[model samples]
Target: MVSSMEFLRVANWVMNQVLVKSCYGVARKIKSHSFDWGDLSYKPLQQPSSFPDIVKCDLEGRGSQTLACDFHKVLLRTRSFFPYFMLVAFEGGSIFRAFLLLCSCPILWILNYEMKLRLMIFISFCGLKVKEMENTSRAVLPKFYLENLNLEAYEVVASVGSRVFFTTMPRVMVEGFLKEYLNADAVIATELHTSGCYFTGFLSKSGLLVKHSALMDYFGDTKPDLGIGNTSLQDQLFISLCKEAYVVMNEGKVMPRNKYPKSLVFHDGRLAFLPTPSATLCMFMWLPIGLVMAIYRIFLGVFLCCKFTMALGAWCGLKLNFKDNNQKKSESDKGVLYVCTHRTLLDPIFLSSGLGRPLTAVTYSLSKVSEFIAPIRTIRLTRDRKEDGETMKRLLGEGDLVVFPEGTTCREPYLLRFSSLFAELADEIVPVAVNVHPSMFYGTTASGLKVLDPFFFFMNPSPKYDIEILEKVPRELTCAGGRSSHEVANHIQKQLGYALGFECTNLTRRDKYMMLAGNEGVVQENKGRRF
Candidate 1:
């Protein structure tokens, strides 16, 4: 029996050697026939006639002509592509994958552009689900793209009647943003290979799409009216196919918030800042300390008094600025409903601390974890008008109650339409304008787990919140004074908007969820808890 086993092992080893040699021979023959290392070398091409700056180009009659531009080079102000891929790795894949990609930065630094891009694609997309990638592209990427957009390039692109974008990045990454936000007529980008709804992290059989070849194929025999790109040789070669070409020398000016083509009211993501290689490394290094600090803050809030927590937290880099209007409380027994702009889950907690007393908070949706760790009492509102109204009235009867009339958190400097329910319940209303600044991560997300919202907010090295208590509404302005509920709600919204320097819109919580998460912003109830 032992001799037979030895013979079997010998036979298996011989067969494996033969198979390896056969595969190597096939690969060598294919490489010799179709691939050349020299083809990857960058050769200098003659510069085109001094191309005009896109900003100075005349826009008259340009709307009727076709235009082509490089998405990364011309549209975005920043030249680095690391932050975007880092987003994909962190949002679509896991943090571990993102760290691995970060670790490969040294290797990427020594490689050529093509090699760097290919490596990034593999590390970011390999084994990620197609649906998750699509979700992140739809919900998370648009905000970053809009924030980094170049104002001059946007003006040129918007003026053109028809537009085409060429990018070396994966089509899935840029296609949605370009088409939906920029109104791009078409996108030409590298396609990724997928197997059974999972990305293989490899390019399609056609490999990286050649921008020049793609431009020619897209418009055969007819030259596009305008081409915009950077000063790279490949970009020069691409624009040469057009009737007119312009080079974009990025001067590092980002499009201002007011100049955005569309209002970025609803975006879902954990990252608050652009994750460049260096910034990402700093974040990883801070995580250990950030986690400990976050837990300590939570513990202090839960076990200690509000004043003590605030004092201790300030030492740990928490900034809380409170502005009190000193509005006198009404002589009536009813509690004052403190209506606040919802910036995060911690708004009520911070407000309670600012007021130097405990207050009941009513929320439309809150995670179980949030409720468990909350230092003050919290009440969840049912969407039913009558039921939620009754719940708020009861909470107000006990003491001063805090309510976010927007029904959801808005990260941008904009306020969603206030729900009228809060206006009807309270006789005396005080509008509180709230704002938060976190350096690393956003405190709210529409598509991610709500339980982690507070932790992420606390994870920042330094987080700041400004709470301004506005003058209380006069008796004649509230619903008790014969005004309609909606009128009171609108009045409160305008006051908060004016205080925070935010724009007031009729958009509701439903509008936000539909755009960001493809839902109606309804949290599923679990064992009597909704989030």
Candidate 2:
């Protein structure tokens, strides 16, 4: 009888061969099948015969109608079955030869079965994809690609992607340059059509929205010659692909010390063409300013720890106003729930100083370091809906609660959806308009680490905050014969937007984080992916 090890190897070979053969069959069927081009809104899809004219974007209607052909339309449609094209074309056309193809596809419908990948961790980091496409009635192929490079010389392939390779702009530039200069046929990229999808596994077929990386791994067994990258850890994967890589620095001129002897770095002062200041030098400039801010924080902490920090904003050049200047502190102090528009961390801190009393602030973005320094009475929100409600109820019973109805801070002139939890907190809901203008270094950001937020804010030269306390809304008026919490929250958000001239967006804290960090929703399993 054959040994178990040999038997398993045989099975693996059979499975791989079968997968490749089946893929060819699918490709053949798809190629012969007539696809419905009418579904797509792009004008190119509607009329392929006009491709030359459409691609040229002719303004004078000079394009010949006879130039239109179905072949260009077919090529566009063929993108949906591009993997099959690549597999057959790359290996000199055959089911047996194409079996050499190696790629990991997200298993379809099966529960933890088939297609395992080493790059799984790398993919999560690129969840948020930045799509850059302009609407035009034309084929957006690389102009150089059409003009140069004979396709028959090498294994010509295209890489279609959304946030995959640390290479979007540079990859396109390199591909174009190579095609022009070397007449090289190797094509690797993330420039994919809207309706293209690459099949990941036997079960996984290409889908329009599927990412290019998920369809297959870009690199084969061969190590890449060289890749260009920025300073992010994710980009490090690309740099390691080559024996020598170009390091592009956005911050300072100092090249980070790397053991790679052949690596070419641009950030160091040696590149006199660009001003890449040393990181050490930047820190030296900040040390003195940071020390001064530390001293001021300690003084502010004393008042906040005691309960209320008085005239806090006035000292920092703050201007406080209200509907009625004659309003008594005692009235506001008596369980008044401050429903404020979201601005920055400085908003609550500065507002408290102006109030002549301390406020138990409910926030989602307080860092531990800032908390230690300021000691403003705060309940850090977990952002869990039910749990937060309980925390707010408990905090509400303590004293006047200051809450930004819009859950997250906005550095720009936009207001996000407010939580209705404030409607239930108290009857005396005072909508306070909190506005902050920083000369430099904003206290709040959509994407910066919370721990460093205070440093950025305090480091600014004279950050000014304005607190405008509006008329209080009673519970009876809010309900108007009993309204839902959502309705009340919506009303407050609309009012704030109208009064402050701030645009309203449905974008939540998650959306902001996605935009800033490309963190696509899934809770990160680890801090960084190690090769």
lDDT per residue as tens, model 2, 1-531: 999646544653453344323433353344345422221111211211211212222223322111101111111222112222221222112222222221222121121211121122122112212121110001112221232222211111121111112222213223433343333334443333223332122211332211224212554454443333333343344445543333332222222223111112110000011001121122224335544553554455454433323334234322445333326344443466788987666566666666666788887756666666655687788768789888887777778788987676665567877777777656567778778775434455332345555655554434456677766665565754387777777877777777777767676766655543355333232331110
lDDT of the candidates, in the order given: 0.83, 0.42
In order of appearance, the predictions have TM-scores of 0.89, 0.45
Using TM-score as the measure, the top candidate is: 1
Residue 319 lDDT in candidate 2 = 40
Candidate 2 runs further than 4 Å off: 1-287, 294-298, 301-334, 520-531
Give the poorly placed runs of model 1, Cα more than 4 Å off: 1-49, 524-531
**What local lDDT score does residue 171 receive in model 2, on the 0 to 100 scale?**
31
In the range 1-531, model 1's lDDT, one tens digit per residue, is 579545544543453344323433444454446332221122225355467777777777887999989998679875677889989999878889899998888787677877878899999999999988887898889999999998888888888899999988899999999999889899999999999999999999988889999999999999999999877778888888999888886544788888888888888778888877666766776676678668767776898788677876676667899999946867679888899999999999999999999999988898888998899999888789999999988888899999998989999999999989888887888889999998888988887778888888988867899999999898899988999999999998998999999999999999988877777877643421011
TM-score of 1: 0.89
